[model samples]
Target: MPSKMIVSAASALCLAATLLPAHAQVPTVRIPEAVADWYNAGDKFVQESQKQKVNERKAKNVILFIGDGMGVSTVTAARILEGQMKGKPGEENRLSFETFPNLALSKTYSADQQTSDSAPTMTAMVTGYKAREGQLSVNHTTARGECNADTIARNSVKTILEYAAEAGKATGVVSTARLTHATPAATYSHTSVRDWEADANMPTTSVAGYPCRNAPGAVKDIARQLIEVSPAVRSSLKVAIGGGRTYFLPSVKNGANFFDPEYPTTRGRRADGRDLTQEWVATRGPGAAYAWNKAQFDAINPETTTHLLGLFEPSHVQFEADKAADRAGEPTLTEMTTKALQMLEKERGGYFLHVEGGRIDHAHHNGNAKRALIETVEFSNAIRKAIEMTDPEETLIIVSADHSHTFTIAGYPARGNDILGISKGVPQRDGDGQISDVDSNGLPYTTLGYQNGPGYRAGGRPMLTDAITTQLDFLQEAAIPLGSETHAGEDVAIYAKGPKAHLVRGSMEQNWIFHVMREAFGFN
Candidate 1:
């Protein structure tokens, strides 16, 4: 039989099966043997549902995985791409966290905005309170650019990491983004403006800006908070690994600008003349070490290193698709997660670790779905590594996104279709099943698209080809033109497993995640 006829026949068979009663007599039909195979396979899934059980014991360790801008559609596309890479029909594949028993939908709005930014969304997750957009950990009552250290202290809410550290658990923060970026910084730093990452980024004269110098070190930038401001962070943050080398180092060293070790052309960002990386190592005394490149990171022995600070790049780390091209070489998200687990596990007391696949959002913003999906796949690999390294009984693993992107998956592509290629599927009603889908302008459209982004063409859509669509640098089509893609206001998914993971069930506000984590840790 022709392939198109087979697909139509299969569709008719599925429709008939749905319409007929269990005992209804039907005309004799020649069904493939795989029908019985699928029936038995599906029955096993029904049996597995009966085995679901809840773990009520308190958790000893907690690991939070945030896939920035990772939405349901992104997960679906990445799962298919992952399976396709493994030589299978992509629909049946699952990301690592997708296998978690308890999952929920998180409404990701902030106190002031519907489509929120990472700063407030992350603050919600870490502090159990939703703040206005651009604010970190501080409550909504505070001004957007408040530079007063005392005012921030008065309005600041404690994060779960701080609680864990205060209770004697080791703490760590890891990300593919700058360590001072909103998502990772929310775990340790509080600020009114997310952009104030370094002393140089702060304003000089405004009443609400750059007053930290006159406040006698009362208020500091996000990078300084990681090293000198936060009590829990400075004293107990055992592992800090990610990019943003310039955020910690001073622009001046020995009376001249201090150049980045990895990027010689770029100097450090701090104007205060303090190298926070040096401070990070000095304050921790004997067991502390700082690494600027892969060689140094590889040499640090997790067992003997009580404190670790690794900054691989001056800004955000390379996307998974571009990591090989990085000058100084960078660690994969999985490698960082493995090293973090190895180091945090050394303390007899349990630990709290925050790992962000921060570059997924960056890729999406650039309208590059290929890199975004690849980053998500790497994020999944890191989650799998964490699961393999920790005991599920004592480790509460929660995976979620701070917010979702406008990235979308559309059209009815065939089961084994290339996720990044033009949409092609068996014809159902009026169209030919064998041809790629076309827009009103007669241009072939890919299955993947964006609501608005750099991919938008002003006049008409471009004719897409397999070679063009499959390239790593290709940007998918967008409906509306914008320099950068904006985030979607829709809710994101939450996947959890281990002690008290049952609390993650049902729809909830994004901030509820913090409460669940706190409860799992047995904090009063």
Candidate 2:
């Protein structure tokens, strides 16, 4: 055969093999070197697909991972960024949860609003019901900031965490945001107003601009609910770790307020003369532990500690990019997750754990795509670690986002282009050796953009250079000017695996996630 004809035959064979379904057998023929890897990758997928069988056995444990504000665009960008960090072309990379066998799209709108907040979306996922925006686990019947305990009790729905504890299973909650923040708070706390995180927050205008004035004990702040009010939290919560430390302590008083353990200049924010951290230890009695810094957190022995509470910051934990600069070190999301799993592993009846990469939402709101993607990568790392630490057969894992940000990834850039940098079209350079792609103003624009955010320039769009847009603090360009970016009324992706994970298939309401979990555990 002619040399050219031999090459053509091999190329054809390679093309046919690469186009076959992942599980299909290929002809026994030599293939070109370039497409050899493609064949191997498909074969691996084939093996994995064959190994995956329907999991119908009741799950003994459950782990719900919420990546706050991680919309579909955020996931695609993060996947690319993570791959690029590993020195790859990036479009082929998948986050840990992306590999889940059962996938679905979750409608994130709340009962009262199309674009939703974390409180209601998370409440929907945990309580099997959509709720009003800004509310916690309670349903839509209760008004926002309703202070009457009787009304709240009637409207409050049981969360999966509560159901697990009632079934004699251990429970845990971990986040990079304040534990009292909407996502993790929905797992255990019930409140009409999410911002009422502490007694000090109750007097704000968002909550009627007055004190709770109901019967003295009719209403309690979110932090207090974690330590004293929530029966599931107080009795069975083996691990509670996150930020928002000041919310648990009282304001400065001769004998009431306590100085922050880590920050010299910061004091507790609570108006009530109560130290909830002390109360957590005292109420749980022996084997209970409290940690405020990385050193203290590292010292906790999960085997000996029956209950653990860790508040790592005065407010939200530092972003992953800035964590090292924290005066008193803070644990990463993966570290917190590892510790929570360790504490819950000993439970005989199994456990239910809620983990939130809460700062992802905050970074997006701030119009900081770099930090948001970094948080998402860290969140993926945490999920990877959880998969490694659990028995897939017994532990059902569900990963999702509460809602989406107005963030977007646009611009027709070539493959392997920097996801965070200005878009460079195919062939990158023009005939005159200038960059090929630019806006009407002849300025380069980022592949990343936001619908509205602080990144908006007051005059006109600024000329974007590679160096400027690639910086860690660079805010992606925005279309509309706003103090902060807003949430979008879009469907978010859901990934699930383990027992009964098949229930997660198809487009579903956000509240359906709770039912899938409930069925996984065979909960009544």
Candidate 3:
């Protein structure tokens, strides 16, 4: 027989357990004091800094590095992979931006939907307004069909780059993908659709096929807008480095021999004339140099180079793993970032540089965990280098993903786990009455795979796993198609440092990133 007090307490506990949800019933584990102290320190620092006045005269430089599809789990996996490669536990290698003094979580939904694409997602970060999934700088009121209308009365939002440039700061855009791609373009260009590249046609005439207000014969391509019209490029942007030289060069010059090799024609040029690259160079002073290869990029001196247009590859540059494995002509992400920062920081009023690890998104789209993890780690290295170069007080450095991938970890084994292998200790039994085992590269005791969603799996081995588990599975159970994973609708994390970084706290909408930057730069 129990004591009266013990019996009463047991009865209350039983009632509470019965009332709670199944997931909530899991016992809460307290973190160690040391770890808790570290977290509390960060929180207190953020709160204290937020209360202080931001002296606009003190801070001048701002650098934003976006790992397009890198979710919290993606960062964890990358850190682990990097650590393992260097012969240490995954947790030993901290991400470059992980050490930021201020941290927050960002809600990444678009205006029209829960899950987000890069177009509106990046647009929200750059423009401070949520738009439709495919739209760029324009708000939800603007229709996709009217994207190219010159005089259409639509609410226009200024991008961070635009604001920074207006405030007399140098701007630069660098990525591992095309310069006209969604993430990079959002900084300066505005269009309803993210995919309308050079070849894609835009709305020219009205619904009746007649010319309407501010309507042109055809819509201007994104590439042309960036090179010809964007205030970032046409006005204050001094260093524009990344891939996608094909979009700028003439067809023959771009290695497309449709026209005469000697007389190259610019692709999709209605009235802009051929030789857009030449025109862009002319816009820069006489000393502007364009380099399409590593040798040319290496030769350009930061002191002498007034303007540089570096397009290292014909298309989206190779994945970090592919580049590292091959040791090819392409420059590393860190190298690109270093060069861009070096050149931009030389400007007197400080600079706004956008560096992106664009391939991380592509890797997740392909369901290639290895490639994604490697690219993510490489991106982290770039961030680490930036941290080493810039001072925390003068520079506000932020590293965040535009959105999250459906990537998840499931099927648990022991603490040390390998992702690319079959799981063991599943409930399903073998005919011989022996515990079965599946072997691959360092056979993981648990299958690191998704269950049913966009990419579904039926009647396969199963082990204990979920969102909160400590495994290396990349995709979620909800992902179907049995091939690639999808993007997650959950809020992503924001890591920040430097003056006024304390503003990022609690869960925030993605558009708040624009405000954070605006506030940090004293634009507000």
Candidate 4:
């Protein structure tokens, strides 16, 4: 392709990005080199498809990876960023799960709303039943924030993890978010409010409007529910890992909380004077152990340990970009997933494990595109690690997202341009009158930005140079200032491989995921 044509294509892309909706796909650069690379990619996919002639079979184990809020744009940007990190042209790169033989798009709308929250979307994925926003395992028949225990109990949908455990299979849940957060908690807990992760976050006294206020021992916070297994299931989980340690601990007498001088929000939320971690270790008996840091987590012996409960932070785990700066030194998502897999490997009846890249959503909500992208790369790495350890013949692996964000990758740049860098191809003129990277406003802009978020600039967008836009602490520019980026109402991608993976095909309802997993394991 001629340089003039390439510049024109780039300019068109820039114009479209500046004008189109945030959910619109990034325009492509279909130059000869790009076209050749795509052809090679297509050929590779064709070859892989030709070789995978395995028949449909039942899965002995199931692993579900949730990249919370990871939509198409996040994946594309992450792929490019990962490629750039490895010193290559990023556009051609593919994350590990992208190679999964079967792929589908998940319609992530909740039963009550088009733009759903994590509680409903994740509950739908695990339970095969659509739920209302903020309700954990309960069906949409239940109201959000309702404290009606009878209604909640009657309407609660049994999750695939519960079914797996009932059949005597080992079960586990891992995430970068708190263990009691929406995604992980939906696997086992039945609650009408996703925010009721700790006692402090719950209503202390019963009001006339609430249903369970007068009942004895009828309601428990999400954190308590995770530690207190129901008598109906096996409850012999091999792994329960993540953050939210503060939610499990009681506040100190002096009113000081779990003191993390580094992270200001690392304060205890449990006002009931209960230490759930200790209770968990005690309930699991001799072989079970509790870990609060990376050193303790690393010392765990999966062969002998019947259960491993790791809480590395007061709240959500640090973003992958800030992992090194965390003095607490929590385990990475990959580390947690591998450890859980090893422990579950000791089970004779197979296992059901849910691993979440939960921090991706948090970063997006904060309008910190760099952390979200970094979190995605780490999530991809964890998926790749799991693929390496599990066999396709017996284990079913899936990678999916609950919903998308208003996050976008716009602003045309030349091939091999830095994904996090300011818009360098916004069309400037050199001394020779040739177009360059600078924008029309004589300012640089980030290649990645959000539709609305905390990063919005009141006066026109600033010319953030690479030095600022590319930093780990940088927040991408937003179209509005809402303090947080809103979730997008578009469908998210789901990829699957291994036994019965072919079931994930075309466009499907989010709740259909539970049916696919059930079919994969022959759980029903």
In terms of lDDT, the best-performing candidate is 1
Q: Cα RMSD (Å) per model?
A: 5.7, 6.1, 10.0, 7.2
TM-score of each: 0.92, 0.91, 0.77, 0.88
- Please provide, for model 3 over 1-524, each residue's C-alpha lDDT reduced to its tens digit, 9 standing for 90 to 100: 32222234345556656987765541222112232345555677788768765434435888888998899888877776676677653554677788776789999999997989998999999889998987778888876655445532245577889888888898889999888888998887777667655532344454546553224543456677676665554667877787776665544334444332212352322223345566778888876777766777788888777777777655578788677443336778898888888888788898888999999988777666667888888898889888888877788888889998877765543222333333333233222221324445433233333332333536542343333223333443343564556677888899977877878788888899888888888887
| lDDT (Cα, tens digit) per residue for candidate 1, span 1-524 | 21222234466677767888876543342333233455565666778877988999999999999999999999999999998899776887899999998999999999999999999999999999999999999999988778888788999999999999899899999999999999999999888889889988877634544555424645688898898755665667999999999989888977987999877889998988899999989898799999988889899899899899999999999889998898888899999999999999877889999999999999999999999999999999999999999999999999999999998888877667789998877555322345787777777889998999999989777888888999999999888999999999999999999999999978999999999999999998
Residue pairs of candidate 1 with colliding backbone atoms: 427-433
Where is model 3 more than 4 Å wrong at Cα?
1-58, 152-154, 199-219, 230-233, 252-273, 324-328, 419-479, 482-484
Best by TM-score: 1
- Residues 229-290 of candidate 2: C-alpha lDDT, one tens digit per residue: 55655788999999999988877766744788888778899877778898999999799999
Could you give candidate 4's per-residue lDDT for residues 331-434 as a string of tens digits? 99999999999999878889999999999999999999889999999999999999999888899998999999998877677676789986655224222321
After superposing all C-alphas onto the true structure, candidate 3 shows an RMSD in angstroms of: 10.0
Against the unseen true structure, what C-alpha lDDT does each candidate score? 0.89, 0.88, 0.69, 0.84
* Model 2 spans with C-alpha error above 4 angstroms: 1-33, 36-47, 204-217, 230-232, 255-257, 428-436
Name the better of 1 and 3 by TM-score: 1
A best-first ranking of the candidates according to their TM-score comes to 1, 2, 4, 3
